[model samples]
Target chain A: MQPTSFENMFKDAFENFEAEVNPQIWVQVQQQIPTTAVTPQASVTFSGVKTLLIAGVTAIAAITAAVVYKSEPKLNTLVESKDNPVDNKVEKTVAPVQSIEKVLPELIKENETQKVQPAPAPASTTVLKLPETTNESSANNDNQASEPLNTVTNQTKIKESEPVVEVINQDDKHENNLSSIQNTEAEKTKETEEIKDFNWGRISNTFTPNADGKNDVFKIHLPDANYFKATILNINGKILHEWEGENGFWDGKDAGGYDLPKGMYVYYIIATDTNGNTHKTKGSISILK
Target chain B: MDEQQLVTNCLKGDKTAQKQFYEMFARKMMGVCLRYSNDLATAEDYLQESFIKVFGKLSQYQFKGSLEGWVKRIVVNVVLDELRKNRILFDSNAEVTDVLQTTDDVVSNMEAKQLLQIIQRLPTGYRTVFNLYAIEGYQHNEIANMLQISESTSKSQYQKAKIQIQKTLKAQTII
Candidate 1:
């Protein structure tokens, strides 16, 4: 007989071995096995995915709606009414007169102008012209009128002589009022323009006091010469040391006069300008000892 | 099924595949747990807990390295949790200078089991380092992370464990 093939013999022997050994171990494994079924968490995961999809769809729909809404034309009737010719003409004619009337007392209170030429022109013209109207008797009244006319001519000559003084005072007052308004508006614009330029750039907080000359001191070089206070904090958020003055220098020492260990620290700087406006910057520093 | 297919099926929540995976790795993981645990029952408990954790966190496994390594890490973490619960104290000295001198005669005479027994008799610190470095082929830096000790301390503890085991074996032979 031919010798049994190693593969067949091995397979038979392995099957017998498994048959003999598997039952006991399997039984023990079953007995120790937890009674609870390992419930599939797929439903929970699917619900989570469903919620996320719904949220994403809602967000996308909201954004699309907002975009479409903004792109659509929306005309305001109130704005259109203000631009209409009838309204514009009425406002243009009335606003200046009302504004002038409102500002007159304030201008007078400020003593910015002198009340001279034409101060009571309309009232005096009406008062003085009444007698000329009532003297309707013909040539018989003319001689009497001529005598009054000579007195009127004398009064006109007196008024003509005072007109130059009145005109000079009125011109000076008008120029002063114009300059005061222009100066106030110019000052306001300058303040707004200055505020736009007040941004401080990147600042370095890391400082090494190892005397190696790499990063020796924590320096906050302000963009401008301003009063500043800097405080150093440890990892526990305790204010370890603080320096308040013009100098932006902080030595790497705690409040208790001890060198802090090598680790991360925080530095906060509060800078105040001459106008009393304050800006704050905070950052972290890594110290290597 | 091939190992990858089995792993894929396990990830798909195929209970049969998961059971096969548990059977394949549980014994070896139990051995790992036994080394870290105080006794057999605690070792068994840690083994079961580690398997549950391993299954729960299976999604995080990126298949970058050996699956066995991932399972072993879970087992070790489970054992460490038990150790932590027992409030085992760890020395925090940064500078550890302890050195153990081991003779060639001690190594030639002592079996691995004898050495293991002596190590198990050691304090938690020395045994952890010895098992991680000597038996598990871990570098001191890796051992440092596992035990939260400085690298130098890990090296020193391993050397101290070797010396203590050698002395014990030497004493046994003389007796």
Candidate 2:
């Protein structure tokens, strides 16, 4: 039989089959259809949702207001001190050290002398001045004590040299100040080196290797002697390709059946050393069509 | 009222047309809901939710295609949204790995109802693809786009569903 003839015959049979089924039962099935109520309780629930949304918004606004109120004073102080040149100069020199000290109490406490030495040591050394009264008192005392004297006479000379001893104590205080300054400079240098190391670890280098004469594939130069697992993900955060093998390279095609679209994609690299230390780096790459 | 007049009157919020419209589409859409839902009660709830959403968003519907198709799409979307909210349909731990290879000899002899029953018994990932691709007449690309999966994943899931259905049918006969 032809396809249309067969289809027409099937339709007739199906209608006859439907007619054989009870029309009352079908009507009863239709009558049993479920109804949803938008009652007063549902309205109350909706109002509650509205209240919650309003409360959430109010909370966000209050938090924002609190942050702004907290930061306003510091901002005003900065703006007010912007005009006074001498005061500004002094503040510029001293404020950073004070702020640094305030921010990092442990660092300040750990290297107290280092904090003092870096800024003031050179200035103090250049402006060195000795008190003259103590020098004159010492000379006079030495002249008075001619020969080997009795204990009482020696005591008398020492008493006369009191001013000289005070001068010596003042000199010793200056020397201590210099030592503290040297300590602070050393600590600062050590901290700077640490910061440099941290920055070095964070540095990410990318090279494109598109098989064009120009940079084709994106090459990541991990810091010397760091092993990493590199993963390339599409815009939807789906991992298109992953490389866990010793050689950290991804040709950009997924393990599935198709090539990825040419667009901006994110790559994540997680490096772990034998020492159980881990570092993560993420960046984007562009694929040319 | 006829379907078109019912739709137009329902769009105007006429209670009679609204009731008639619900009566007309509820059963077929309930079947759609039942296929996606975990149970009959949940299916009924989904159907209610879908109708409410359809009524609310009726103004956005452009009359470019069959109204039935548009309504069916809305119902399917509501089911998907419910699945997402319940967290059972797309559990993160459910990973689709290698496709299962099964002999077609068993699948060829299976009836449509038997095939559908087996499809229903498959995992959520496989069942969704089987329903969308095989029954709903969606392409792999469209399924991928709608489900937010790769096209390859959609194909693989359909293949896995077929293999699973074949195996289940074979096992049932043995029993």
lDDT winner among the candidates? 1
DockQ list for all candidates: 0.02, 0.03
Per-residue alpha-carbon lDDT of model 2 for A198-218, expressed as tens digits? 322433334444556565455
- Where is the poorest 10-residue window by lDDT in model 1 chain A? A71-80
Residue A104 alpha-carbon offset, candidate 1, angstroms: 57
The residue-by-residue lDDT of candidate 2 on B39-155, one tens digit each, is: 333455556667766776666777778877788899888777755543433323324565444435554454443444555455667777666776566788988898877777777
Question: What does fnat come to for each candidate?
Answer: 0.00, 0.00
Model 2: runs farther than 4 Å from truth?
A1-289, B88-116, B173-175
lDDT of 1 by residue, A1-289 (tens): 1112321322222221211122223333333333232454745533433454446643333323332222111111111122233233222222323323353445323222211112232333333332342223212223433445434433432343244344434544644554565565444223344444556556765568787887877777666536767777665445677776647466687766788788899876666566544445567977767
Residues B1-175, model 1: lDDT tens digits: 8767777777776768778987777666665665564334345556656776677677678877888878888777777775665455555454445434444455544444444455545666666766666656678898788777788777777666666665666677678
TM-score, candidate number 1: 0.38
